[model samples]
Target: MKIFGLTGWSGSGKTTLAVKLLPALIGRGLRVSTIKHAHKGFDIDHPGKDSHNHRMAGATEVLVSSPKRWALMHELRDEPEPTLEELVRKLQPVDLLLIEGFKRDRHPKLEVWRPSVGKPLIAAEDPTVVAIASDGPVPDARVPVFHIDDAEAMAAFVVEFCGLRA
Candidate 1:
């Protein structure tokens, strides 16, 4: 599967744009999958649940299955965080893979920029940034710039850049 990424400083609308792009891409008949990296510890398991109990009892990996879906939660208790590539291999193939975060990884990414955040622009130094979605005019941007609210345009850019077919 082809890969593209959405990245930006916190509060810069990366998730918002991803939410908009999902249906846009899917409407074109593409099967889409997403991988998101969380900077802080987050848990999908709830206390009192069997799966949760298994994890708390020091199971390194817990696989919960049902008629509808199966979820595998791997606990890296003392292991290093897996690289982006490592995580990608765990995902089932799809027409497109949209990754959020892992900004330091070498992948084509669209930077969602908001000047008001008062943070330095990541695209300024990251050559992997193929395009930018900004809240305002960015005449100095090194790559194509689209209005942050223009989900259709951004989605089109991604499909073209990744050479994706519907």
Candidate 2:
């Protein structure tokens, strides 16, 4: 599967773009999946839940299932962190995979930039950044740029970049 990343400063609207792009990609008959990275501790399991108890009891991984949904949680447990490539390998095959973080990974990326955040631009330093989607006018770039609200254009960029049938 081809992989691409969407990255930006906090509140720069990466998730918003991702949310918009997924449906468009799916409409083009592509199977897509996403990997979102979180820096802070997060728990899908709630307190007083049986799955939470199982996890606290040293279970390395837990799969909770119901007719409607399923979730798999794996404990890192001090292990060396998995790289983006390794993580992608664990995912089922798809036409494209959109990764939200792992900004340092060498795969091609589309940066979501908002000048209001006053955050430095990563594309200026990273060759993996193939393009940018900006909430405001993007500075002159060596790669293509798209307005953040143009989900169709962004989706097309991704499809072409990946050489996917679209």
Candidate 3:
């Protein structure tokens, strides 16, 4: 699958952009998947849910399924975090894979920037950054720059970057 990354400082709208981009890409008939990286402890299970009870009962992996959707939750018992490549291998095949983090990975990426954050732009330092989506105009850069509010345009850019026919 083609991999595209979204990276930015905290509260820089990466999640917001990702959420917007998915449906737009899907609207264009592309099968898209997402990989979100979280540094802190994260859980998909909910309290008082059967899946949560299963995990609490020492089940390492719990898969919950319904007619419409399914989820596989795995516990990394004393293991190191999996890399982006490994994580991608586990995902269902798609026309594109939109990664929400893993900025350090060697893949084509877009930087979601917000001037309010006052954080340095990663594109300024990372060559893998092919574009910037910001609420404000971005400084001159080698790659295309876009406005954060325009999801359709950003989705189009991502599709072109992946060499997909609209």
Candidate 4:
């Protein structure tokens, strides 16, 4: 699958942009999947859920399936966190994969920036950042800039950057 990324500091609206961009890409008849990197530990299954119980009962992997959907939860146990490439390989093929975070990985990315966040631009140090989406002008940006609210434009950029056809 063609891969692209959105990276930014905390509270810079990367998730918001990604959420908007999904439908824009889907509206163009493209199949898209997303992978988000969370800095803190997260859980999808709650304590009372059967899947959660199975996992807690020493199941290495627990897969829950229904008519509508299925999800596989794998326990890392002693295994280290998988790399981006390893995680990507586990996904079913799609026209595009939009990754959020993983800024250190060498993939084409758009930096979601907001001056109000009081953080410096990541594009300055990351060559893989091909563009910036910001609420205000990025005067010193070496790459192209887009308004943060322009999901259509950003989606189009992603399609073009990944060479994905509608």
Best by TM-score: 4
- List ranges where model 3 is wrong by over 4 Å: none
Q: Which candidate has the highest lDDT of all?
A: 4
lDDT of each: 0.92, 0.89, 0.90, 0.95
Pairs with backbone N, CA or C atoms under 3 Å apart (clashes), candidate 2: none
**Residue-wise lDDT of candidate 1 within 1-166, one digit each (tens)?**
9999999999898899999999989988889999998999999999999999999999999999999999999999989999999999999999999999999999999999998987888998999999999988775788999998888888888888888886
Query: Which stretch of 10 consecutive residues in model 3 shows the poorest summed lDDT?
Result: 135-144
Of the pair 1 and 4, which is ahead by TM-score? 4
Q: How close is every model to the real structure, measured as TM-score?
A: 0.96, 0.96, 0.95, 0.98
lDDT digits (tens) for residues 66-122 of candidate 4: 999999999999899999999999999999999999989999999999999999989
Which of 1 and 2 is the better model by lDDT? 1
**Model 3 C-alpha lDDT per residue in residues 1-166, reported as the tens digit of each score:** 7999999998998898999999999999999889999979998789999999999999989999999999999999888999888999998899999999898999999999988999988999999999999888777667888888899998998898899865
Q: Write the per-residue lDDT of candidate 2 for residues 20-121, one digit (tens) a residue.
A: 999989988999999998878888899799999999999999999999989999999999778887888888898899999888878899999999989988
Any runs in candidate 2 off by more than 4 Å, and if so which? none
Q: Provide the clashing-pair count of each candidate structure.
A: 0, 0, 0, 0
